[model samples]
Target chain A: MSTLNEVLTKNLHGLYYGNRILLPFKADILKAVIEKSIITDFSDFSEQAEYEIKDNRTEIYFYEYADLSEFITTYETIKLIVVEEGRDIFDIKNHIKLILHLNDGHEIKIEEAGENFLFIE
Target chain B: MRKILPVVLLAFLLFGMTNQVNASDFVNPAALSAEIVNSDAEHSLPPVFMVIPFVTLLLLIAVMPLFAHHFWEKHYPKFSIALGTITVLYYLLVMNDTHSLLHTLAEYLSFIALLASLFVASGGILIKVDKKATPMLNVIFLLFGAVIANIIGTTGASMLLIRPFIKINQDRIKPYHIIFFIFLISNIGGALTPIGDPPLFLGFLRGVDFFWVFEHVWYMWLPTIIVVAAVFYFIDSRNNDGQEKSKEYTGQIEFKGYKNVVYLLIILISVFIDPNVISWVPNLYPLPFGIREIIMFSVVYLSYKTADKEILSSNEFDFEPIKEVAYLFIGIFATMIPALQLIAYEANLLGDKLNPGIFYWATGLLSGFLDNAPTYLNFLSAAMGKYGWDVNNAVDVHNFEIEHAVYLQAISVAAVFFGAMTYIGNGPNFMVKSISERAGIKMPSFFAYLIKYSIPILIPIFILVWLAFYYGRV
Candidate 1:
């Protein structure tokens, strides 16, 4: 397996925005991500809705930036595995959606506030 | 008010500097207009003293901010307008040069309109990046900012991205990051396209092809960007302690204010709406501006009025940065006419002795100190004059481009790249510095930025570019 640093330095193109580094995967990596079943959806919308990957409390949202057609098609194939796992996307306490730790001794807390996402950094 | 008194006395001082022009001259304006504005008339060159206002203004810009920050903050607009008025009165009363004055006014209007519209429009859109501050990630961000600078202009890209950049590096944020941002994104990045920098836009207005700069300067620009980015990467890596505990990251990115994107597109498209480019576009001649400027100013008003308040608040959007640019640049544009004319005369007289290398250094060094846009114009006027061509004439400008592409390339690259050398070199450099300072990033003083960062980091890269591209090409 290629290291995350190698993938980042070489193939993967990323633009940093909001509370996440948007990693737009392409071709072989996209295929590997699908075939290896790395990103499993956890929502009931299943076939029609957006795709996301759950890793601990961090939720990578795919409702933005990525426009690759394969990204859309990969959603349908990946939804079934997520249903089998029966994992909840929102399992964190106090409605805190995400927590980001900065190198300069700062912290960013992303919370779900009604229809809005509040970022306390 | 007390402010108006000095301005009026300064106006009298300006008139006192000039020879007598009777108030009765206004009654029969046609004779004065015919005598001055006629194409065939042989006018005397602007006296050397006329250049003082421009030089004084530039000196004040470089010195006052460092020495008298509070006073400069409160009265910069007054200073700018007063100096600009001196030049305007000198031209109108002494030199009787309405044509040059009018032409310069048109350029200034176009310049400010484009900058203001981009500023207001980009102010509405906010990008929020939630990522760790790593050397690699920072390099990528700088690289991306450079690319986008060509599209939205250095001003637009800097305003849109600087906030997110500062936020992302909040914990590890240092002065070097902001300085590199000023160097790469606010200056050198804009060399590839006319939309990228004010100097190139002025060149475009004067009749250089839109893609001409990209074609000529990209190879040089790419290598320069690489060298600068590499230096930044090395510096950044050493600064990294690698002690932060790894936290789970979702890689989330949020972008707000989609309407501003459409507004940006409109601004970009409007750039090509000049009657000079499209035949159907109506020419609003005799007036100092055109259809393009009108559209730009309209977008400025509309974008600000309709912007989302939440996005504006989050970005800390205010008109102060653009206002400073507007006031300062109006002074620069007005005062530069005499200097440009004098330089053109000298360049023509010494055309044979002056080569591409000489033009390159002359333009580069001056651009680092003076506002790069006018410096670009000054050198361009000089170069064209060397070929016995006029910068104001479209045919002459196009012909000069065909005959002397290398000189244009040198001036174009130098003006844009060397602008990174100082806070006053480009409009966005100051804006970025102000924005960073407000965000609590202690930016370097003017001399410190030059002595520490630009002279050390940029000069070597610029020398390499010169040796590679403009060495012995005359």
Candidate 2:
């Protein structure tokens, strides 16, 4: 192989985003992100969601945002999604779902907020 | 209480501006129309003093964002509108060429429409780079941009690539990555076709064949891209922290809103349709620009209506960038009219000394400061004057393209390439900077960027092109 990067760029470039940003990932990182990253703030535009989170110990910052509303909601179907899709909803896809809550009621969530319920900051 | 002053002033400025917007509402027609460049049958050159507003206003775009950051950000639209109003009044009253003004506005509207459509459509599609921020990967990204910039237009390609470029390289992003991206993708990549950059598209409007740049400038583009990518690789390799953070994103790369591509294609197709001449307006420029504007706007609407709002949300797309461009370019396009007329007059004065090398340096240097679209027109018009061609006639411009191919080539390259030299040189440079800053990349300042990165890297590459293409041809 000339290089995986060479192949990746060529194949990835023809897709929707076409900038090689549509990165494929494992199911585990999103779990790590949800737990280890201390979400300092969260907001979204209309159905889009964004969270300002920092690594719990290192204090490093990373952001998570997606307008995944089309695929999610409290419409009596979230439980079905959880069962069928599992935590892939929060996987590092182009978008991630808003949150997850434990049986003990501890919460991990992104708040939906902003101007005219529209735009990104 | 804090917002009242600006709100009051905005209202005052808006009212005052609306009252006096006719073509000759401000300037004394008898005094200022002496050296008019015949835009049509009876149009004259804009007065020399008009450059003051143009230069000062453009300078303020770069300067105010630094020292007066908060105040400038809040008041920039007003500032832009106020400066644009000066030119509108001058054009209406002093020159009394309503026909030329309308023609310019028509062209201006279409120009803004294509840019806005690309911005919105491209922004609607999010690209998430899962690759690690390696030197090799960054080079690949830059090369892809360099190729695609010609297809989508620099602003379009820049909007698509900049975020993902920033994201993938977020950890190791030094000043060089962003700077090189600007140099290669935002400016130089657009050198080969009218579809690539605004200046070249204007050349197309005046009848230069679409394929002319590909035939003439492809030789220039290839080596320049390679050399720059090599330089970027060297710099990036030296800075690698020896930590292997290269990891794949954890899910299959996915997409939403791919249909927006159809809208983008529609916008591109509209550029080919010739608009009808508004005969009653009298003294029209050749391009039926109004038709293109209508079609591009319609595409923008169709894309918005059809794409799920989720696509826009996932991409974090917004309209603020376009609004800012619209307001500021009105100032830029309007005020630069006189400056161009003056440059044309001076170019005419040079007579036969208008060599290809002269055209190259002159057009390139001005593009770094003034927006390149008009700067290209200025030098091209001047070169036409040297060949005794008519500046207002499309047929003459086309003729100049044939008779003085080398000079036309130089003008095209200079206007498109050197825009990477400064922040305001191209529309997307500032937008990219703005977006990157939001993503937490602290970009270099205007003077600092030139002194350090752009001048060192780009000037040498430009010199090579000059030596190869234009040294003896003029």
Candidate 3:
């Protein structure tokens, strides 16, 4: 019954799920991802994460997993795990479900209401 | 109204002088003094031929229903119309009856109107031109304009090509580098020929050989081409880098009908034949009296008929841009008459003491601010007077060491280069800027444009020109 905010605070990682998440890190990362695959050296990212900041919020896919153990691991704090059925993970047709799992095994699901928001499901 | 008053007063002063003078003044000393005063007054009046009809046309165009549509209203609607009306009023009411203000006005207006028609027609053509090919289309249009400047004259090319440039770059959210390209390529690229610019054309008519420009091609052509190409490359790179690749299309682009291309060709050919028409060869071809006119009007008619209606419908072709050009240029051409006359008549009085370098700098500076063509002619004439006339042999170099031809070449080069210094210096500069603005590129303001772009970019080009052409081995 942990809230998404509490899980995000405890894990020190937040999950974003939509079409393409506007990385809070830097724009060159996105550009590098699109142009060249290797995203080495994020030194250009400002303390405020200036490079990735866009005029509007970036969109990323949303997804949910039925069995959280498949995505969670002992050493890693799962920042985001999105699940889709009967389609590729990036496919728009399948409903997207997103979960943020903390090291403590607390989980929060991101859902769509009017806008994208985090919630415990 | 404020601008029109001086012109009216000048007109009245000229009219009073012409009427008050006696015919016997030539025989009698006292009467001759009066005649001299009258002639002075006449000269003081604005060139009525260029003035009156321009003003009248401006007024009519301003009040016309077709001019009040949404397009004009959005961009310079009221100012353009008001300017046009004022121009027409100045010419008709203020100028004296004897001056050729009306005739000159008609000639220039005809020129402007022909350009207006071309702008509208070509804009329509752009809308019909395949959207995917727009970038290639723009490059083609720019190259075409550059080439045509050598053939028809820069003003002619500018008038003919600007609409298409305006239309191709009409999509909002695009960059405005095209305006700078037009100034460099369309305006200055044609520096090598008398036919390429009005000043050079004046030179040809004034006894400079039609091919004299070719003699200095090594000096003029190379610099112009190199500078323009450099500017184009820089701009094209910036535009490409800034824009995102777009894949969305409604799949609605179709040629509809392309027979209008022929009409465009005819208009181009007319530029070559325009001098001939004036020289009367076309008249002697044993066709009807207004046969040339008939042919010209018919071409326009057919083009209008054959243009893809759907494309025109999509672009919402309107007369706003043309109307704006027509109105502004009327004031420009009219007010300019007195200024040009003064320069032409009084250049010798200012002393032929000015060297080619001084003339180059002076003419370039003025041409940068004023219209370059008239500025070129004024200095060209002054150069002629300074070099002296062999009354009998017709070629004289008074005190100058350089050949008269070299001086002429220098002046021509200056005129072309300096005309690129300002938005209003050449016709297409403003049109290209406006089009880019419409496309949503925030172009710099008048002084800001010069300070930010021209000074930094064009100065180096000018220096290269100086070393390579004017001060170089020729």
RMSD, one per candidate, in order = 16.0, 11.7, 17.9
Which of 1 and 3 is the better model by TM-score? 1
Candidate 2 chain B least-lDDT 10 residues: B25-34
TM-score, B chain alone, candidates in order: 0.87, 0.85, 0.67
Instruction: Name the runs in model 1 displaced over 4 angstroms.
Output: A1-121, B1-42, B205-207, B241-248, B388-403
DockQ of candidate 2, scored on C-alphas against the true complex (2 decimals):
0.04
Each model's TM-score? 0.71, 0.72, 0.56
Cα shift from native, residue B51, model 3 (Å): 15
What does fnat come to for each candidate?
0.00, 0.00, 0.00
lDDT by residue (tens digit), candidate 1, A98-121: 211112122222111211211211
lDDT of 3 by residue, B1-474 (tens): 543454334333323333333332211110011121224446454454544443343343334324442343333434443443444455456643233333234334334534544554454454223343244445556666777778655654664454444434433223334555656555676787766765555454344566777676536666666566666655554554313436454534344335555665665555434322245523322111123334445665666666676444333344434444544555565445545554555555663666656666677776776667667756765666665542112234222213656667777788887778877666666665554443224456566667766677776777776665555333
Whole-model Cα lDDT per candidate?
A: 0.67, 0.62, 0.47
How would you class the docking of model 3? incorrect
